[model samples]
Target: MPSSPPNPQLAKRYISYTVDDIARLFGIHRHTVREWIKRGLPVIDKQRPLLVQGADLAEFLRKRRDARKQSCAPGQLFCLRCRVPREPAGWQVVYRPLTATQGTLNGLCGTCSARMCRRVSLAKLTAAAGNLAITTTQAGEHIDECPTPIVNRDFKEG
Candidate 1:
């Protein structure tokens, strides 16, 4: 008897994709993709960064792509700083790739880029807050200090 073929859904699903691919396919910014992953979205596995599976992209695109729309012309790039796509200009042509292997990134408006930077700094600040410790060292007394010496030996003079 002949065996059945594997389902197309299971036919060698992609193990990873770059942030640019996810952003282009899902109609969102690359930073948004990272942010979603950081927020504990089921799609992110973070064993490594800038690589997402086909399954994750499909799920995210299915959920979010329809709600957002763009009207950029062909060959235009989105600007993270301005939140719009425009033809590449002298100063607006910055290509910041997330991973070296992923190649160049689609540009965002200058404003969007600044916003992304701010968000990243804010995240670092929030992480630092989680590691904060309060100690009595500022009061000039050490908690580990004892009235008696920890190692005291009685030595008689010869």
Candidate 2:
């Protein structure tokens, strides 16, 4: 499945499209475009070649994409597998810092037990974390930046 929905911005609003044209333009199967019509995508009329206005197609795709959006509320992580927002299991979350002020909150989905993560700001960590117990941890430094690397330590200099 596509990570993101097709871009409606690519459609020319002034143009009209046939089922095959829409499938080609959006890189989807012709049947999928036909399904869209049955699923409420408007058409020109009951004519020989079905026609969908570019504006209508774009709007339909935009609305369909918007309908699939799952926004995480406070102390919640969006579970990729479940396609919904879920609170972390056991009310515990790990805060891994990415920068001085920004970090990510990682947790397990209570329902599916799948790993989930959400970006959060240090300043708003409290509000985002809600009642969950937070364990703050630093991200590991780059390997090359280490004072004495294992490979260098094992190799002797002539």
Candidate 3:
């Protein structure tokens, strides 16, 4: 699930928080808060209960959340299955306009063969096409087509 934007009001109200306070504030398990501490969340440890400063925690969370965001260059699209930006297998992509200004770029992942797509502005399409070979089509032209069939891999339970 995606996280909501940080609340400036709440961040300004509290100077510090305990593990339990952080857990309750985010409606998450206390173990998750402890995990955050292990993940480099700064804390004040001189007292009996470790305290996480509001500014530190905010910055930590912000950085962590931002780290997950991936951007695609002109010739690339983000593959949901692989969770990375990848070029199309043949350096070719299909564009389907969603609106006057926005559209979707579709392609096959060069590595994993997953169907990949990324939303982009129409203004950028020309620059993106210059970087790669692109075929523009109507919305319903090739919605059902896939360059490669998806293979399901079974994982063994630990």
lDDT for each of the candidates? 0.36, 0.73, 0.68
Q: 50-88, model 3: which lDDT tens digit per residue?
A: 898888888876664554465677788777566567888
lDDT of model number 3: 0.68
Please provide, for model 1 over 21-138, each residue's C-alpha lDDT reduced to its tens digit, 9 standing for 90 to 100: 6555444466665664654335445565557677765564443333124434443444434434444432232222222222222232334342111111222332322222211122
Candidate 2 structure quality by residue, lDDT tens digits, 28-139 = 7677777679778899997959999999989987876664575678888765445466898998988888879987787888999977777788999999888889988767
Q: Is candidate 1 or candidate 2 better by lDDT?
A: 2
Could you list the CA RMSD of all candidates, in the order they appear? 24.4, 14.0, 10.2
lDDT of 3 at 137: 85
lDDT of 1: 0.36
Which candidate has the top score in lDDT? 2
Stretches > 4 Å off in candidate 3 = 5-67, 142-158
What TM-score would candidate 1 get against the native? 0.27
The regions of model 2 sitting more than 4 angstroms off are 1-4, 7-23, 27-68, 141-158
> Measured by C-alpha RMSD in angstroms, how accurate is candidate 2?
14.0
